[model samples]
Target chain A: MIEAKNVNFYYGNFHALKNISMQMEANTVTAFIGPSGCGKSTFLRILNRMNDLIDDTHLAGECLIDGQNIYDKSVQVDELRKKVGMVFQKPNPFPKSIFENVAYGLRVNSMGDKSFIAGRVEESLRGAALWEEVKDKLKKSAFELSGGQQQRLCIARALAISPSILLMDEPASALDPISTSKIEELMYALKQKYTIVIVTHNMQQAARVSDKTGFFMLGELVEYCDTKKMFLNPDKAQTQNYITGKFG
Target chain B: MKHTERELQSLKEEVSQMWKLVLSQLEKAKQSYFSGDIELAREIASREKRVDAFELKIDSDCENYIALFSPVAVDLRLVLSLMKISSTLERIGDFSEGIARHVIEEDCNRMPPQMLEDLQLDRMFDMLTGMLSDSFVALESENTKLAGRILAKDKEIDAMYCNSIALIDRFLSENPSFIHCGLKTLLLIRKLERIGDHCGNIVEEIVFYVDAKVLKHGAKQNKE
Candidate 1:
């Protein structure tokens, strides 16, 4: 479970996320959708503290994972990240072999021995829905796979750590339609074990994949409700206009 | 100003035109029944084909708009309502044609003017026509304020329809010679009643499109 309580974030002096509060249930997919520069991705990164990597960024209020404030001074950022893994818009697999690309997370975190790592690598690949395609070429370079395969490899890399929550920032934006569909299917399957939070520009994808949808506009969460109601008859005029392509 | 908006506007206009045509058919059906204008009855029968054509066109256009735009919320509701409203209008057109058929088949003009008045048939036609025309206005204005008022008019039509049945029964008992004409007049009133019900359906759809509230089953339950 993840919850944001009056969370406001700033990039230098400019506010990136206004006072926002939402709760994402365990094992349910929550999709954040908006136009470009609406801070959906910013709020998603706030979940796992990925924004902390950038300079001059400030955050106020609480972002709690399982009721523990992740932004608290006593909270270990690395441990928090290990508990919450992320996949980016573009696949950024390491230059290592396909096996090591998945093994990289376990290796860096010093988790499991040789045999345990091998079994976890296969399990993570299967979890990402990429095991069968890359199974025979475990020793081949990750670059040898197609774009979609590489993206799934990044998903496998994220899943390798056994994180409780998966933060996906437009994980399928760069892939072709079939690959995008595969990623969507993978998200559906992954939500059984992980609370998936995704930021997508594709409204249809959000409608198809998420149980709950959050509509953000100009750093404010315009609406958050069931995916069915959000697409059928949203509570806000701005949400209706934006989804119907009538926004100014 | 957007492409979908323009397409939706054109679709709305097409339905509006079809609505006006159907309303004219009802008006002409009444004229034929009272004034013995068999020519107008024949014209109503012939124009029924045009009403059917408009329904098919609007149905296909709504389907195309959905496939092309994948509209959401209000746009989606409008397209769906337009599809059902056109279908409801087509059914009303059929009822109007049925009324016109009675005019062509029988000589209702022979019925005593007092008998016609007793049946309240003229008042029924006027109320039905007014309800239909007001529904048209409600849809064209994209306002549902007239929905409650327009839907209530159906009850008046129903009351007249019930009264006509008893009036016809009394007239038939008194003058057994006019039994055939009286029974036929009862059927004509029944057609008008059905048209009123269809008009109520159209008003429900207009409310759904403009206000996104389903009044179909709920309205019926309230009436019950």
Candidate 2:
């Protein structure tokens, strides 16, 4: 489980995230939806200290994963990241073969023998639903695959490390409809093993793929509820207005 | 500074005015049919243009709001439901005109008064009117329970429609000379039934507003 309690984030003097609080369960897909710059991406990155690389960023909230404070000084950022893998909006596959892309995490961590790495690579590729398409081309560079295939490869790389949580920021926004649907299907399948948090601008995508949906605006979590209720009928007037395309 | 509030209020007013015009047309159609007043029937038929215009204006407004604002959540549902409800209302207006045309064609003076009285079509019209009225009220008030009750009341209208068909058959058997009138009354009864359907559609919109559930395809499987 992931929990944020009265979380507030700041970039220099600008308050980027408000006193937001939410709990995301294990092995479920939770979607964050809003217009651009609503701080959904910021919140997602905070889970694994991805924002630590940014300059002048300050946080004053408890973000706990599996009942442990991820922001504690004693915690190792590198290990935290390995346990909580992330995929970005664009498919940023490494400049290497498909097999190497999946094997990159294990290589960096110096985990397992050569045969074990090979076995794990095939398993991650299969888990990402990209094994059949790229099985014969495992030795080929990731750039040789189409945008959709590359995205699946990226997901495979994320899963290669055996992360318990996956954070995706518009994982399918850069792909075509068919590819987007493929990613959605993958997310559905992945949720059985990995707790997933996604940020998206597409309302229909959120409605279709997510178990729970959180609507954010101006860095505040306006409402969080079941996806069906959020899309078909939202409780707050603001939430309803946003989903119905009445106004941003 | 939320533009959605203003647009939603405007949409409500537009639908309200359209409802008023539709109800007026329905009333005028009944008068012309019973009294053999061709002039009033023609007037009602001409007024259909206004309903059509309202539908067009509302459609354009909804499109503009969607294009300009990129609304989400309840505002989006309201716009979508309004677009559907407006089209349904326009179709209802067309049915009203159809009834007006039938009144103008048939020589109502020679028809038996007992024919209209026995069909209880006026009661059906009353129910249809009440249904539309309640649906509009539910929309404005965001009343889910009232909307659910309106949905249930649709069955009453459906039963009345079935009873009308039986009444027409009975009337035809008693006086074969009135077969033509019976057929025309049957067509009018069908139009009223369609109006009930539109009212039901409006009720559906209201339920969407109050509960945030589509209920369009029945209860969805809970993801939670």
Candidate 3:
């Protein structure tokens, strides 16, 4: 479970997220949707402290994972990140072999020995829904796989760390339609184990793949509710206008 | 306006045009029946085809809008309500055409004036016309405040329909020679009653579209 309590974030004095308080349940897919620069992705980044990587960025209020404030002084950033995995918009894989790409996470963490890393690599690939495609070519270069395959490889790389929550930032935006659909299907299957939170520009994809949808606008969360109600009969007129393509 | 807004406006206009045409058909049915105008009755029957054409066009257009736009919230509700309203209007058109046929087929001229007055045919026609036209205004204005009043008018039509049946039986008992014409008049009244019910249905759809409230199958029961 993940919860944000009155979470306000700033990027060098420009407020990017304003008083956003929401809870995402375990094992359910939650989607954040809005126009560009609306703070949906910013808020998602806040969940795993990805914003800490940037200069002059500050966050106020608690970002809780399982009721523990992750920003606490005693909390370890790397340990927090290990429990929260991320997949970016573009598939940025290491220029290494396919097996090495997945094994990279476990290797860096010194997680296991040779046989342990091999079994974990295969399990992560299967978890990412890319095992069968890349099973026979484990030693081949990661660049040999397609863009969609590379994205799934990144997902597998994240899974190799054994994270509890998966943060996807437009994970299918660069892929073709068929590949986008495959990624959407993977999200549905992945929710059985991971509490998936995704940021997307596509409204229909959010409606299709999420159990809960949060609509953000101009650094403010406009509405957050059931995906069906959000699409069919949203409570706010702003949400209705935005979803129906009436907003400027 | 946005592209979707323009398309929705065009769809609303199409449904409004069809509503007006169906209203004219019902009006002409009343005119032909009372004034014994066989020519006007024939015109109503011929224009029936145009009403059917309107329904087919509106149905397909709504389908295309859904496929092309995948509308949500109000736009989605409007498209769905428009489709159902068009179909309900087509059914009303069929009843009007059926009434027009009765005028051309039955010897309505021979029916005694006193008997026609007793049947309260003019009152029933006026009520149906008012109900249909008021529902049209309700939809056009995008205001469902008139829905309650418009829906209540159907109850009056139903009461008249019930009374007309008993009145016809009394008239038949007194004058057996007029039994055939009397029974046909009862059927005509039944058609008007049905039109009233369909008008209620249209009002329900308008309420659904404009207010996002489902007024069908007894609102209270549905809410419960």
Candidate 4:
């Protein structure tokens, strides 16, 4: 449901992304893979104007979500963010009670009905696959949970608002293998309800989770194709070399 | 420094040399079987160690590359397929040595006249040689079409194998005294049939390289 057309982005004349264009289909996981500093995260943040927070950053492109350019002055940034939720590389949960952590989004958006908010908190936690573990301890602080639990709690917090799109930047990188796999499984499950765009350095994870894979190198989209073909037999040598661990 | 290029070149050379050695052993065995030379058969049997050593070396090299480089794409496929194809080649070598051992024990001169003059057995050997040679070429060139063609030839070899079985049965009924020689000849045909299988495996590897598809079991059926 997101489309970027001939997108050129710059950090004060140091062209970070060059004429990058891609269409993200609704309710499918699309993974962006490349070496570090290839502008994958930059392109991801621009979807919801997260880049607008950075000074001296200029963008020239049409980033459309559901046929309307989000960069248009008429579009509201707050509304765009509410529609497009994000989770960071590390789990950044507010230091609050587990109940309040899920309630924070509804609270800020003035969704302030005591019993209604409680229902949403549980539902969001359930949606994020964190409800069973933390249901009895809703009043316990978020810090009491393990890294994986905390990350899932953070996901619950993001899902509290009922966003249609979820943008994840290396969501499982800081977690252990079991946690990583859980997150991968959660992503696969989440795709039926939300469109996901994940940027990963792990090629195998990208192959495992995504329906389509975009191989990026030095801020260029070298190849984009079905995940199986991309991993088994990529069309470009650069894509092949990068995925095979032959080169960075 | 990335030594992938160097490692790939080294692997290519090693596999090529191993192919040459195996082919020479097969040729020696065939010549010994034809020329009634028991010493040549014994020599082929003794040289089996070299084939075993080559297989071990290639296996270790592939494992080292995988552990160190974590190769992807075509490189990954090549290494993986090479590991499998190497073992198949080694097995084919063992079969060749088995045939040589049988010839040595049976005393080549005592082999029956009808079994020795059987033209179908000669045709099967010639087809086996052709399949091996074509597979080697297909692997070197990464020619998927040629590989498929070579794979199709395997059925012809199978038909020859069936023909040889019928010939053996006919000879056994006509002369019961030649049972030992008949069984040995039948076993030799079985060895050749196994060689055709190995050649089919090599063709499969070539197809994997060219098309990135694993077509080993029921490959022909699937194509149909």
Prediction 4 global C-alpha lDDT: 0.85
Tell me how each candidate scores on DockQ against the true complex: 0.79, 0.37, 0.76, 0.55
CAPRI tier of model 3: medium
Give all TM-scores, in the order shown.
0.96, 0.72, 0.96, 0.84
Could you give me the TM-score of model 4 versus the true structure? 0.84
Candidate 2, which segments miss by more than 4 Å at Cα? A244-248, B1-21, B38-72, B79-204, B210-224
lDDT per residue for candidate 1 within A1-248, as digits (tens), equals: 89999999999999989999999999999999988998899999999998999999999989999999999999999899888999999999999999999999899889989999999999999999999998999999999999999999999998999999999999999999999999999999999999999999888899999999999999999999999999989999999999999973
Listed per model, the TM-scores of chain A against the true chain A are: 0.99, 0.99, 0.99, 0.98
Ranking 1 against 3 by DockQ, winner: 1
For every candidate, the chain B TM-score is 0.95, 0.90, 0.95, 0.93
lDDT of 3 by residue, A54-112 (tens): 99999998989999999999999999999999999999999999999999988989998
Regions more than 4 Å wrong, model 1: B107-110, B220-224
| B1-224 per-residue lDDT for model 2 (tens digits) | 45557777887799889988988888787778767788999999999999999999999999998897665556677788889888988998998899899978865434476767777767877777777777777777777666656666676778888988887797779889877767777888889888887777777776665566676645322210
Candidate of highest DockQ: 1
Q: In candidate 1, what are the lDDT values of residues B1-224, reduced to their tens digit? A: 88888999999999999999999999999999889898999999999999999999999999999999988889999999999999999999999999888888866436799988888888899999999999899988987888878778887788889988888888889998998888888888889899988989988888888877888865544422
Angstrom error at residue B77, model 4: 1.7
